[model samples]
Target: MIRALLDPSEGEPVQIERAGGRSPVILVCEHASRTIPASLSNLGVKPDTLTSHAAWDIGALATAQKISQLLDAPLVHQRFSRLVYDCNRPPEAPDAIPEMSEIHAIPGNRNLSGEARQQRVAEIYEPFRQALAALVAARTGPSRQPVIVTIHSYTRVYFGAARHRAIGLLHDRDRRLADTMLQQAEEHGITNAMRNYPYGPDDGVTHTLRLHAVQNGLLNVMIEYCSDLIDTEKGQDEWAALTTRLLEAALERFDIHAAGSQQA
Candidate 1:
């Protein structure tokens, strides 16, 4: 969906997309893509940096969009580069709106005054969050909401390094959705699933899951796939079909652990 950002396009670097879904299961991709406006070309980062994890998940947007299509799920995503500001981080954290990320140095973010940070918080961050919170609040109320599934893709390696070969199923204090989804993945013979790979709910991951899931008390999990795994249409469709199967199945059997535990 096209959104409004009060800050000038200079510091304003973010986008959000949404699709309809029957379940309360909302998909969020905080570090979706890295496209710097012409005003600040490349964020002073090299081509390698753009390709690096510092920019965004290499092919996460494609996979996430595909999953959304397969499941007809609403996806709330950040359009700008994470180097500009991380939608997954709280505004208080320096990395919340990073000045430099790994190889890339964001000239726009550097020497940013308080007004500048607040400008981004008000413009890009707040709008994206408000959109998501509104979605959850609407889906849930006196009635039950569907599981909130945050979509993410991580590199097989970090900083030109290789990591363990497994897709991570991430969650924080809330595990019902992750547990159910993990069980379904394993049952399908997907043996390489990582309980929490790359990073967990901790390690400064804020915004998306914390705001849309944990704080809201929605059944939620952050699902990640290896970059190489879903880079191709064949691979993308593979994940889409398999994940949709697991999500549909788990959601069907879901007891709304968040609601029922207290309801009883």
Candidate 2:
């Protein structure tokens, strides 16, 4: 039998916020937490490395929470480090459990048996994926289909290259939400928004969009904020407010009610 990957003291693999909200928006922060379950021993990584962007998307959960509060949307987020299993990536993808993230080589994930791999997938990825799927399923029907809005954060500099785009609205084949948001970015005070910059569909970053949203024929977009821009509470709030406005305008274009339905 494969050993348990998470201790009882460690939290569940996924967390759902604002589950009872009435909005048709479903927010997801797959890389929300930097926590590595106690069983992994921090994946043999340095303490600082465990806290870096490799472990989680800095400030993304906070921003998503704010958006959830403002829009009264339900949010589903992963609760473990992505190094254990990137909830955004499917189980078949090798990088779902990356051995190397940027310059840091994950000693714990270097080589794994088949069972070990499946264990992570079952314990970490499935719960997060299922939670989001359930939310989408529950909100999907003839009267309303939930719009998936995934929140992510990217490093300001990667592999010694500087990234200047403050915001990235990413999409796969389905571009409805992204296109509208990009068209409304500047007017919403998001001056540095880019379409699929830093990473795009070809980069395999759209797995979550492809699996949960596109496959369900639901509208979706992956929103990426530069980590430096949202590392603090003030930044998270400001960006959340701006993103809330942008999403509101874009959703209004879709004929979805964008105001006065906010959670009290």
Candidate 3:
């Protein structure tokens, strides 16, 4: 039998926030936590690396929580570090359990028995998928479908170069929501908003969008903020407010109402 990677006492693999919210938006922060199961021993990475962006998307969960509150939306997030098993990545992807993140070699992930890998998938990835899927299903209907929005953060400097983009709106083949937000962001005085900047769908970053939104025929978009912009409570609040406004405007532009509101 495969040993479980996560201790049940530690915590569940997924965390849901505002599950009873009335909004039609379902927010996701796949890299919300940087927690590693004690069994992994920090994946043999340095202490500092555990806190870095490689482990989780810095400031994303806080900003996502604020946005979920502001919009009264439901949020589903992962509770373990992406280094354990990236919830956003497909299981077959090499980086799903990366051996090397940026310049840091993850010694623990270098050689893994198939059973060990499956344990991470069973303990972490599967739970997140189920929770998110259930949340989406609960909100979707023939006349109304929830909009899926994912929050993430990127480092200011990568590979010795400064990233000047303040925000990025990423999308896969479906750009319905992202296009509207990109245009509205610029009009809202966020001139630095770029489409597919920092990371694009081609970078294998849109698995969640493809798996949940696209397959379900629901509108979706992924928002990326620079780490420095939302690393503080003040910054997280500011961005959450700004993002809420943009999302509201986008929904209005599309003439979309919150799912089940008509019946409510």
Best by TM-score: 2
**How does each model score on lDDT?**
0.70, 0.90, 0.89
Ranking by lDDT: 2, 3, 1
Ranking by TM-score: 2, 3, 1
Residues 156-250, candidate 2: write the lDDT tens digits.
99999999999999999999999999998999999999999779999899999999999999999999999998999999999999998898889
Model 3: per-residue Cα lDDT over 1-264, one tens digit each: 855687779988898988988889999999999998998888889988998888899999999999888778899999989999999998898899999888777899988989888888888899999999988988788876899999999999887899999999999999999998887887776789999989998799999999999988889999999999999999999999889888888988878753334323
Give candidate 3 regions above 4 Å deviation.
258-264
Extract clashing residue pairs from model 3: none
Query: Any idea what lDDT model 1 has?
Result: 0.70
Error of 1 at 32 (Å): 1.5
Tell me how candidate 2 scores on lDDT. 0.90
Please provide, for model 1 over 1-264, each residue's C-alpha lDDT reduced to its tens digit, 9 standing for 90 to 100: 223333364543434444445445577888887766454556666688777777887667777777777666677788777776677887888788677775566666788778767766776677778887777787787776656777777777666788765578888888877788778787875778877777886676635666777887777778888888887888888887777777767776764322122122
- Candidate 1 differs from the real structure by a C-alpha RMSD in angstroms, to one decimal, of 5.5
Higher-TM-score candidate among 2 and 3? 2
The all-Cα superposition gives candidate 3 an RMSD in Å to the true structure of: 2.1
> Which pairs of residues collide in model 2?
none
lDDT of 3 at 31: 93
Clashing pairs in 1: 15-79, 24-146, 25-147, 88-206
